[model samples]
Target: MTARADHLVGVLGGMGPAATADFYARLIQHTPASRDQEHLRVVIWADPTVPDRVSAVLEGTDGPYPAMLAGARRLCELGVTVAAMPCNTAHVFLPRLVADTGLPFVDMIEETVGALTRAGTAPRAVGLLGTRGIVHSRLYQDRLRAAGIRPVEPGPEVQAEVDAAIRAVKRGELATAGDHAVAAVRRLAGGTVDAVVLACTELPVALRDSDRAGLPLLVDPTEQLAVAVVTTCLGAEAHRAG
Candidate 1:
C-alpha cells in the first residue's frame, strides 16, 4: 500500500480565506480513520487576491491568468493527485485551469451532483443560490439538468440578500454574522422543494447552524467535496478495504 503522505489533496481555495480554512477543519474532523496516516495528504494555496470570480467572468478577467495558474501549478509541484477549488465562481475558469495546470481537479459541480444523486434526491426542484455570475451564467442550472434535476433561480429580490451576504463575507465579516443570508435562504427555501445546496463555500460556514427554512438544507459543498477528495485520493485497495 502507498503511504498516505505520498498523496496530497490540493486545495485551490482562499476565495474567502476563512471558508477555505473552515473546509480544511471540517475535512480533518470528518475523515474516517483510526490513525493520523489514514488522513488524506493536503496542500492549499489560499490566494485571496485571485480577484472576484463573479466580476472577472461577467465583466472580464481583464488581466493575466498567471496568478491563478501559478497557484495550481504550485500544488501540482507539491505532488497532489487531485486538486479542488472551494469557490464555485472560480469554477468558471476551471477547464482552462485543468488544461494549463495538468492537475486532476475534482469538479465542485460534478461533486455536488453526485452527492445529490447518492442521497436519491434527484429530480427534485432545487433553489439556486449563488453569485450573479453563477446564476446569470446558469452554471449550476446546466449541470443540475445534466443530472436530471430541476433548478429554480431565486427571484431578483432574494438574490439581493444573497449578494449582500457574499459581499459582506468578502469584506471580512464574521462567517456567521450575516443574518440576512440565513433569512434570505430561508425565504427562498420556503414552499420551494426538497433541499437547498449552499453552492457557495462562503455560504456553508457563513450560514452555520442557523435555523432551517422548514425545508432540508445542504451544507458546504467544500466540506462534501473534501470528503470526495479524500475518498478518491485513497488508493483503490484502501477504499475497497475501507
Candidate 2:
C-alpha cells in the first residue's frame, strides 16, 4: 500500500542503531519547525537483526534481506506512507525487496548525489568512505558515474580501516565526537578529493575528532533523503502548518 497523505514517513532502519538515530535527527533538523507539529511525523523500525551489511558484502556471509523485509513490512502494516533505510550497504538488496514489496524504499545514494549536484559539486573526482561492500560494489559507482562524477575509493589499507571503524560503531566503541576513525578520515581527507562522502552510517563515529576538516563531506545520506521526504511526503503545507 501507499501513504494516505497524512500518515508519517516510515523508516526501515537500525541496521546500526546509531545511523538510524542520525537519520531521525536529520529529519527533525531539516524541517522548518516552530512547534512539534511543524516537525515531520516519522515512524521508524530500527531493527539491528537485519544482519551486517558490510560483513555480507565483504566476507560473503549472510545479509538481512529477509529480516529487512520483515521490518519494512511491519512499517507498512503500521500505515506508513513512505519508507527508507539509513544504511548504504543494505541498499544492495533494494531492487529485490522493492520488486516484491508494496512499500517503496528511497534511494540513499541518489539522494546524496542530488544533494551534491544541487551544491554544485565538480564533476570530477569524488572520494568515498563506506563499508567494503559499498566500496567494492558498483552501487555508488553506477549511479555516480551516471551523474557524471567519477567516484573514487580508498586504498586497501584505508578500506580495511573504514570497515573496522564501522564494525566498531556496531559494537558501541566509538564516541559521538568521533575518536576511533580519525586515521581513516585523515587518509581520505581534503587532499584526496574536492569532497568526501562518509558512505557508511558507521563513519561519523569520530565526528569532529576525526581528520574530517578542509574538504566538504557528505556525512549522512539519510539527512539528504530525510529532507526530500519531508518536502515530498509531508509537503509545504505540513511545513507551513508546522
Candidate 3:
C-alpha cells in the first residue's frame, strides 16, 4: 500500500529533546494547513538516549550514527514519504542514515544556504554560530562559498561563547544560553556580515526571543529545514491525492 498523507513525515531526531520539539513546532507553523487533517502527518522517533554527536566528532567514537540509523530504518519500514533530522550536528552522520535506510533525506545545510540565496536577505557575507563540531567540520562553509556568499566565522573567544550557549541550552538553561548567543551574534555582526546563521538547532530554542536590537539579519537553519520538510511532504501528498 502507498504511504498516505496521514503518515508522510518521519523525524530522525532527539539529538536533544528540546530541539526535536522545536523542529516539530516550526513544522506546524510553516505548514499551510489550518486544521488537524490539513496538517502534514508526522511521526517522530525521539531517542534522547543516543550518543552525543559532538563527542563522536571531536573524540572519535561511534557517536549517535548507529542509533540514528536504527530510527531511520524503522521510519522507512513504516513507509514514510521522506525523513528529516532537526539537529545540525546530527547531520554529520546523515549520509550513513540515508545509505542504511535507502530513503531520501532532506539536506538541512543545503536548504539553509538556499534559503539565504533565494530570500535575498543576505547578499554578501554570512556569520555562523554553532557548536565546535559544526565549526570544525566546516560543514556549511564550502556550500555557502559555492553559493557566492562569503562565510564569516567568529573568533576563538566568541566561538567559546557559542559553545557555551549550546551547552547551556542542552542543560535547559535557556536564559543563560540566550545571553551567550546574543553576545556572540553581536560580535560576529560587528565584522560586517550581512546575516548570521543559527546553524545549530539549539540556538533557536536558546534565542527564540532574545533582543537583537542592532545585529545583522539572523538566519535559523532549523527554520529553513522546517520549510523544506513542509513543502516536500505537502507537495508529495498533494501529488498522491491527485
Candidate 4:
C-alpha cells in the first residue's frame, strides 16, 4: 500500500509531550504499512511551552489558542493537508483553529464517540475519564448524548484520582499514574456504565494491560484518532490494505 504523495498528516501536539509521542506511536502502529514507503508523511509541531489548556477552559486563565494556531500555521506552511491534536483538553479550541487555518482536523472527541456507537454491541452507558477541562466543557458528554449514549462521569474524588494520574504521567511516573488511573476506572466501573472512554490522551499512557483486566471496556481516543488519521492520509482502501 503506497502512501498518497499529495497527502501529509499534521500533528498539533505537545500539550503534554508524552501524550504527543504516544499518539505518534499509535499513528505508526495503525498505519496499514508493511514497509517504510507505505507509511504516510507526517509533520509534528510539538511545543511543550504552550500555555495550559485546562486552566484556559476551567479557570479563565490565558488561552493556549495562540500557540496552537501557530502550530497549525506551521503545519500548513509545511504542506500538511490534515491535522490532529492528541490532547483531548486542547480540542476546546479546535473550531477556531480550523477556521483560522482552513486546515481540516480529525476530531478526537467525535472519533471516540463514533467508535462506541459503531461497536458490535454499542454501549448504552459509557464512563468518561478525562481532564477537568474536557469534563467541564462537555466535550465528550455532548457528543455521547448526541449519539444516543449515556455519559457517566466520575465523582469529584474519583476525578481527583484522574487528575493525579495525568499529572503523574507528565512527571514521568508511569507506575504511580497507572495506580491512580486504575483506581479511578475501578470506581467508575462500579457504576452502571458498560464501558469507559479514556478521554484524556495521558490516561491511555497511564493505564496498563494488567490495569485493564477485569475492568469495563476501555476505549482509547488516541488510537481512534490514529486510525482516522491513517484513513485520512492514505484513503480508506489503502488504510484497509495493511
Best by TM-score: 4
lDDT at position 177, candidate 3: 92
Positional deviation of 233 in candidate 4, in angstroms? Answer: 1.6
**Collision count for each candidate, in order:** 0, 6, 0, 0
The CA lDDT of each predicted structure is: 0.75, 0.72, 0.83, 0.88
lDDT of 1 by residue, 170-242 (tens): 6777453467678667778775657677777777766765565454666457767777776776655333221
- Show where candidate 2 strays beyond 4 Å: 1-5, 59-62, 121-123, 190-192, 208-211, 236-242
In the predicted model 4, the residue pairs found to clash are: none
Q: Give per-model TM-scores.
A: 0.88, 0.86, 0.91, 0.95
Q: How would you order the candidates by lDDT, starting with the best?
A: 4, 3, 1, 2
Q: Tell me the tens digit of each residue's lDDT in model 2 across 44-127.
A: 888887777776877765467779888877887887766788888888877777776778667888888877777755546677
Per-residue error (Å), model 1, residue 72: 0.8
Model 4 CA deviation exceeding 4 Å by range: 1-3, 238-242
Best by lDDT: 4
